[model samples]
Target: MRHAVTLLCLLVLAACARVPGPFEHDPSRDYYARPRTDKAEVAISPPRNMPPQMGQRVAATLAMELQSYGIVATVAPADAPIQVDGVMSTRDADLSIEVQVDWRVVGRPRTDEPATVKTRARPEDYAEQSERLISRMAQQAAPRVATLVGKPPNFIPRAPGQVAAGITIPYEFPSDPAADGTAAAAAAAAATGTTPTTAPVPTKPAEQQIKVLVAPVTGAPSDGNRQLYSGMRRALGSSKIVIVDGAGEDVFTVVGAVNLTPIDDRTGKLVVKWVLKDPAGKIVGDIEQSNPVPLAAARGSWAGFGDIVASAASEGVLELLEKAINRPR
Candidate 1:
């Protein structure tokens, strides 16, 4: 009798922990999660509970798998051919659902199987199974996705971090080197016509007036880093990258601590550290931006600590811009 009671209690707990099953999301109503493609022109919001990578790994694997099946497809934020959206859930089975994939160019409706698959397992076993099944199903649907894209199915399995890797944090006041004192001097000379001094101009235009989010985790935001945040915001905004109303929309949420500890000077990069968080305050990206700051770096040199910080931060910031630009719409 005691044994029977224990079994009942266990079953009750198991039932209480049930997750949603397949077909749970209503794509007809847009009540679904989306794909994670670094190539997406805009980042769709992630579901409330899952990590960013969870969606990315699954999306990439799914896209690759769908491609194998000859479906005409592309990842979401795709203004391309067909946009394949995904919905994931688990219960008696682990299910990664396409919910519904929309086509920018309509295709022949299916008289055949709907896009779905399910693998039954314990709660702990669901995540892996769901990923694999989603991948397999996506592979099965590639032909359709390809067709929707009006191409011979060219689907690239984007590696994880490709999106995040593109996010960068800059550390320069005059992100546009053209805005430096030399440029100022040139402008002054051009205005005053005082023996017009000649200063070589940099050909590459810097991103300006692009309002960026600075989530610093370093010991302190170096002067260069602060300048970068200020300058890049200005440059990107003025660079015609966004509409006036859309200015400051591009944001990178930093997370983690930027370790500034250098084992040695000169050989040691300035101690820099930080990470990024999503708008919901979830951390998705991290990095340490520091290069060897020579002891002599104190003596103003061309490659001083300030210069190095700006360079490192600029690299990080540029990456962020790339990610922002590429995120799915």
Candidate 2:
């Protein structure tokens, strides 16, 4: 099965590279013809502007795949934690067909990213080849959608900290209602004439501190970018993020790019892009941020620009780190 899936992915890529021009969309085919399992419901939103038949087929294909994994999938289920929607458009690039999909969690607009797939095939076979690639891409994305929706309610991701120092999260599990139900029930019965007692909720701890490496900032002039490194260190350090000089086992690396434009003699706009990566070099996520600057304060030296941009970067990183720590695994 794994080999078949791998081959399907490779074939889809190869076919997309050859297909050219507008692909035909057939609306009569049934993509979900296999037996399905009964499970938790997932809503699949019909992709907007796509050919009706092709869109429905893709949605059905996703729903069928999800059902196999113990998730009940439907077209627009009334209540679901997440829904899948996609938009397909073709462009002339190396005479190949490209399909892009963007999936997100319901009510969480920030988790949007594109998943693209391609196929290489003759122009005469573009329609069949395109559908094949779309179906394959839908299949590939189903597992990820299911996993995201299946995350535990109390899931807490590992704190974003230094690779060398690692993170330490101090937490106490809340009392389980099932375990204390009998006692609580008896207490409630006895206290019917009075107020019933309740368990105290556990308090969450402060952010975990770890070693962080703030790489020298880039994308600005050398003369004005001088104090960026130190400024970033100070800004992030004040937010419970300790800066380190070198990489280590638990060290987190912060890389930044800034674009500063002079709006006027007294005003400037700074756009800072930040990327956070672990010691092993896997990207945690972007911590990029932007803020307008007062040229009067940020004009005299590169340090002035560093002060404003680094502070914004610091705030952005803190926000993303907190979200990562609290996000479901």
Summarize candidate 1's per-residue lDDT along 105-149 as a digit string, tens digits: 324355533333332232432344343233323333334433434
Candidate 1 lowest-lDDT run of ten? 1-10
For model 2, how does the per-residue alpha-carbon lDDT over 12-105 read when each residue is reduced to its tens digit?
A: 3224523221111122211254333233367887666666766776676566445423456777744654565655565554444444455555
lDDT of 1: 0.35
Q: Identify the candidate with maximal lDDT.
A: 2
**lDDT of candidates 1 onward, in order:** 0.35, 0.51
